[model samples]
Target: QLDDDLVSALKGALSGSLEALILGLMKSTAQYDASELKASMKGLGTDEETLIEIVCSRNNEELAEIKRVYRDMFKKDLEKDVAGDTSGNFAKLLLALVQTRRDEPSNVVDYEKIDEDARALYEAGVKRKGTDVVTWIEIMSQRSVPHLQKVFERYKSYSPYDMKESIRKEVKGDLEKSFLTLVECFENRQLYFASRLNEAMKSKGAKEKVVTRIIVSRCEVDLIKIRTEFKKHFKRSLYQTITEHTKGDYQKALLSLCGGDD
Candidate 1:
């Protein structure tokens, strides 16, 4: 009771700006993610990659918090902004993700449902004349991770090809990439981050922004796993990649977060 009273008194005493900073310091990961997303989209040219990374990486609960914090910080609906800034299937995918309506995780894996969903995807893509993008979007957006994992596994046996190959054969352009990234994240989030880091570092001139975003955002989450995946996939340490690609305080900071190369 006394602690609550003292906190209230401090809140009353402190300036709004100071209080806001203090609050920000105490904000949750979802809130921080929301703020980062808002900043990425606020400028003249949108940071589309950042927007996609954030939206695709977060789960339904985290996305709900992001939506709330985004509205509080920007005074604009995130969905509307995303719609306005992006177009076509990419926009659709982002909007679907922002809905935060995916199924809750379940301990029991429903094989029947997985087989059905896998067949749905197969019919929508490889088995059809044209891709049934809506079916893909709906399933990808709504299904739980465990459910999707089963779906992908079932897809391999149900069809002659892997899910990624099916996607590759069916769609082209940013939409295809978006769906593939979603699948990758669902399968293994740490590997997805590792892949993004590799892409950022490998790109010409190097995407410093992407590198910074991944390292900063993931440092507290599964960065250790990401580092291991990086080494496994790339055969080079993420720390070494950062060291070779970046210089000065920037390199030092990234290496510090990486906690040395494996």
Candidate 2:
């Protein structure tokens, strides 16, 4: 662990985006996630995109740790904070996820349950007149990734559109965004992150916080795979994209975290 005085000195020495990145790096993964969550909800308006991305992408254990750390760091309950900040079904979905009740991934796949869930989702959305947001929220927030993957595959046989398309058709606003993000993370987390990174830099002005969060959070996890996916999808390397969008020490720090060009 870094010493408290040393960490404070480094915090005092650094300024701007570089300080955010460096300080982010010093914390444990759960602590970083907790801080990011707090930062997203701080101030007048909430950053719904950041909240969605972080909440939707994390797994059961990771979320449990984040919720615990969030309370410790902020002296507040993560679930209550989410409920207070968001509204409607979006808040329901986020609160469900923050409960950390998702089943663990296992070698054993329950094909029967998969088919049942696929049917449930299909009936709830495409087959019915009105969408059942509750059913969607329950399945999406509680199922294991591997189970959901199989469910999505089976769902294609029942509905005209895939799960993501179905989500787009069924819901609107932040709820839709959260569901889609969850589906993408389920399908291919690294690829989803690569797409997010590309989107962050592709805008007129780069979304620096999104870029920093993705890079810093994923650096030790699957950044190399994300780089590969970035090149494959965008026809440009993430390193070059960072060079074009950011400047000075911020760019340098990002590039170092990115590891290398694809």
How do the predictions measure up, each by TM-score? Answer: 0.84, 0.94
Which candidate number would show the highest TM-score if scored against the true structure? 2
1-262, model 2: which lDDT tens digit per residue?
3567877998899997888899899888889999999999998899998899999998888899998899899999999999889998999999999998888898887889999999999999999998999999999988999999999999999999999999999999998899999999999998999999998898988888889899888888789999999999999999999999999999999998888778
Model 2: clashing residue pairs?
Answer: none
**TM-score of model 1 vs. true structure:** 0.84
lDDT of candidate 1 vs native? 0.81
**Root mean square deviation (Cα) for candidate 2:** 1.7
Sliding window of 10 residues with minimal summed lDDT for model 2: 1-10
Clashes per model (N, Cα, C within 3 A): 0, 0
Q: In model 2, which runs have C-alpha deviations exceeding 4 angstroms?
A: 1-12
- TM-score, candidate number 2: 0.94
